[model samples]
Target: MTYDLGVDLGTTFVAAAVARPNQAEMFTLGDRSVVTPSVVYRADDGELISGDAANRRAVSNPERVVREFKRRLGDPTPVMLAGTEYTVSDLIGAVLGDVLRKVTETEGEPPSRVVLTHPANWGPFRRGLLEEVPGMVGLTDVGLITEPEGAAAHYASSRRLTDGELVAVYDLGGGTFDATVLRSGPAGVEILGMPEGIERLGGIDFDEAILSHVNVVGGGALDALDRRDPQAAVALDRLRQDCVLAKESLSRDTETVIPVFLPGRQFEVRLTRSEFEDMIKVPIESSITALTRALASAQVTPADLSGVLLVGGSSRIPLVARMVSEALGRPTVVDTHPKYAVALGAAVVARAQRGEQALTQRRTDTAAEGGKDADSPARGKTDGSTRSRRWPVPVAAVVVLAAIVGVVLAVPHIVDSGPGSGDQTAAALAPISNTPPLASAPIPTAGSPLPAGATPGFAAVSPNGRLLYVANGDAKELNVLDTTTNTKLATVPIPAGPPQFLTFSPDGGRLYVSIFDVSGAGSEIAVLDTSTNQVLGQVPVAGQPYRPAVTADGRGLIVPVHNPESVWTIDTVSLKVTGQTPVPPDPSWVELSPDGRKAYVVNRGANLITVLDPASGKITGQVPVGAAPNAVAVNPRQPLLAVVNFNGNSVTLLDAGTDTVTTTIPVGQHPQAVAWAADGQFLYVVNDGDNTVSTIDPRTGKITATVPTAQTPTSISVLPDGTRAYVTNLTSGTLTSLNLTG
Candidate 1:
């Protein structure tokens, strides 16, 4: 006997099913996990590893591992692994081939026909890429369907849908989100309108948040690790697994304990479901927004839709059900096996194509009062009324529900505008120039007892922008990297106290590092000659300094001395302090104007930016800002000063020329530091509490992007080009790089 094969290739996970007789059997590969993570890792010896092994190897070999690749399908650029580039299709093919191998091992032969499913919002280029995969893997005859359509087919098989009845499909997977509305008719299932989808928000994002939480509050043992260490891989993999289990457990329970194990020390973290919901609230709200847009485009209200099918493994999160119900004013429809629903739908079609009897003893969900239906197969058998209806060929999610009496509907009227309804041609066909390659390094000082930026190394770009220097705290070393190759050029060892701040000369010829003691003593600046990549000399300062700013002419460096409450200006030529300007009780960071004429220092104790004339040790002006002002930034081209208020969770915009307050803009939780983008058009603020980098428009005072970082991001530096940025995560000890263009 021959069985039909179906493949469900997901961004975060992969699954396959074999259909025979009346039921679909999940094909397992090596492990019992019916779903395999779509990850590939390049082993130390050049071995290509996939699935669980790849995941297991990621902690130690992060740079060599590639996942979440499906999101970049049809992109002109390929993935780089172990110094080698791989096309998008090549990565996907690896997963498909592994699934096929499982099929051959379990079924004893290749399937006669195969059905494939992907997101409904994918455009022509992505679809074209997917279509080519089947042929590459030796699958002769392949039928393709959108994920939403496949899920609808699975639901339609068991539940009878009346002609013209419409159902909404909400599929939230690991890497993306999609919402579709489908209708059943005499011809079969057809899409009512354009599908709704969010490309970036997904389950994986939630996982990352939880992972960051682990790093921040999980205790001393858990910190960013160097992939070169074998334990690093094992530790990270364990943490991820624990997070997944904890997340899954929260679906049924109110709280779960996550176990974090290090070599000698281990700890258990108890997390509440409510807390998790809060962490992922943004994405949930986004999905709800997309859902409403899809409903509007479909011209179908919550009351008009027959069923709201919740598809994808991530839908199991209790928050999804609550949010969808609250927003739609009705409970969502779910299958007992929501994770496997889409694959099941494609599997049934595959079986039917193999000439097997389509009738099955399947669970049929009935439209009920609360909008919730049975998810288990024990509920009921397939309805004979919709048995003749088959999945349509051209694709969209298919769905059917019994309508009241006879309502003759000629055709689906779909609206042309809304989110995800645009001509998706730009999605895959065009090269995504904004997407940039990123590199990360473990801040050896992460989780150290020292304060935020002081312990976590901060990055600075040389004047010429050719090199990026990252000063580490506990490691007591400076990591010099080549920007062009994203490779480490050298590690310059410095005296032991964790570095709080550093600055490059205007010409990028010299580097100045402010090293501070954890106990708030022994403050000094180590001057490094960029040419030789060595510390030239150490200039003793009166007190601990956090962040230092360089003057435009490259002649002086303004250092904010914290404890002693003084700002010191050092002459570049003499390599000695010109003078110390006495300031408020505690100065945190300093910013200098373009002309090297003025200095703006954020005084933590004074709640103001104490302005000083660099020419002499004198106070020029003081701009009162929010309480606990931590850092300050200046726009060279404009007379704008941005002050990050730590406790206020906002940024106070000050007019440098008039020394007057201009605007008070709200920011993320516990804003710690601020920097002006090269153009002065935008400002980047590091939010330590939320582990996010908030990009704000200086003119409108509105946040543009809240890019998530590892944990406790303390310091951020951007190149003059504004295309690249580096953030130091204090607790996580991970130096994160970002592509500013996006």
Candidate 2:
């Protein structure tokens, strides 16, 4: 027999199915059912046991029995059973091998090919183990599909769904909760969004809650009963079993009696559905929150969803169903067995591979056919149908051809333009020379005036090259410097506390300041009007707002909240929060694209930049940066992104269009801040530990110069005309202005 198998090797359950020659005749092993509990045991003689046999041995030999082995797949720790040490991969292999043997025995032949289902968040290490399991089971060629994707494909195929249909899959399993949003079509299923839950949570948590309740009701006697008398211990064990039964029963009933037995005495404790709901409310609420976030990420409302499918046995809980329904405002579809859906879907996918069904072609053909039918009536009903329709066909074909030609012609221009495209004239400017003149004069810092009591943090020059704002943490203010005169003009008081970072509005009329607050009490952002040189307003933000940026239109300000997983968006006009978008942890800096449509937030903790659509509040993509991206600067004239890595001591240049790191330019020690020249001629980076400024030509992405500065130079910026630059030194408490014209 040529069997194509799909395996769902879950933490608490293992399921496998085989697609027959006839696609509709897919058969599941074990009485033709799709699921089996994932239980394993090792005998004293080192023989492996699984499924019913292992489950039967669980109570008698708890030490040697292993359940939920999938959870430990990524851990380096090994499990010792019956004096034999086995890794998580080995344990999983045992379960998978057992299932493979059953399929072979049931079909009276070995399976030809297999596909494995995995969680979306599985890393390379975990994926490696998953791939290894199929090999161990003697399946040489194996494919992998995410659990959610498998379930989504199943739903889409069963209903003959088309592409662009958004669906949410909420999987509450034995050890983890995963939520995913997918768009199904003829091109297959594309994952639009995915959010993970606590790995420590699941049905086991509910069981533990019940066990805890049993102990509480039995009082201290439950502990004594286990140790003092053998008969009492057995009776106490029975109570634990009864608690589990009652918990499952409460899902379909309003109340259940959990019986506790000790020696010759027996007592009954009643549990209401309300009490059970209350017990697991936090977890259920968390699941709802994850689902909400998944929808938000996909930029869809509950009304836009086709449906919400519940998968995994834990999703059978009454509270889980209720919470999902309430949050999504749609009835939960639990028609398919939660534990078997993924495996069944995978089996269906396997049949598609065997040419029994065309999964990808189904939706595409339907859409095209539907479009043709819709257009037929329009062409026939029009007054000048013959000529008008004929003209439209040629015109549309010409317009499409012209558009393709336009894109091909503009490729070079787009490559030269930065993300901002803010300065069209900059692209026409002559290329600057990288090699300084042999007789180049030293930068005139001899008469530079240092601000008193100012410990500089970061600095930036206005777009028009008139003023430079330096974050002076020790003085608790921003020292405004006159760029032309190389002198301090005024110290603007920052009531939001100590200034840590600064960015100017596109029009250069406002300055946005972020303050570092470590007490966890909270942080505040102070907006100052550049013309008035006075504080306009202060808005409270969660954690310390580490870095700040202003949108190109000056309509919004983005701030990174360090602790909590969010970025704060404030309306520049109203000076109020428009929204807050959750991000990866420890977002230390942010930068907006030139068009003001997208925002890039640097997640220091995750070592990646989350690209967000500010208008839709959705993360469009993520780009991996160097270790600890302390600062990010985007060139407006081109699709260039420069990130300074403090620990890695290098600047990573990313081609935003391709989302790939083009080059890594090694810089001085501890690069802290990065900025692009107004004309996009050069990229400047400040090295805090080395007290130097590294200059690179963006076209070549090579460091052309390393200009030494005052002690501990923390920030650097260039003038709009590209004739001068500014550096803030924290230890020396000074802002040094460099003459770049020479």
Question: Which digits, one per residue and each the tens of the lDDT, describe model 1 over residues 1-742?
Answer: 6778778888888888888777776777537577889898887776667888787767666778888998777455668998988887888877888888878877788877688887665544466678898777777667776777668777877777778776767787787666566767665665664543545556777887788788778553556566566676677777887888888888899998888876656777888998898888755764564454466545677787665788888888988888778877765787778778888788877765444222222213233333343343221121211122245322233321111001111111222222222121111111111212211111101111212223455777654344566777887766665443244445566764666578877666667888877776677888876666656788887678768888777777888886677888788778788887778877888777777777888888879888888778689888799979998888855888899999999999988779899999989999987877655667888999998888887766777667778878888877554445678876776677665533
What's the lDDT for all of these models?
0.68, 0.65
Runs of candidate 1 with Cα error greater than 4 angstroms are: 43-47, 53-64, 219-228, 263-265, 351-742
Question: What TM-score against the true fold does each predicted structure earn?
Answer: 0.50, 0.52
In lDDT terms, how accurate is model 2? 0.65
Compared with the true structure, what per-residue lDDT tens digits does model 2 show for residues 254-351?
A: 99988776775677778898988888775565455444335544556778766677877788887777777886787677735677777877776665
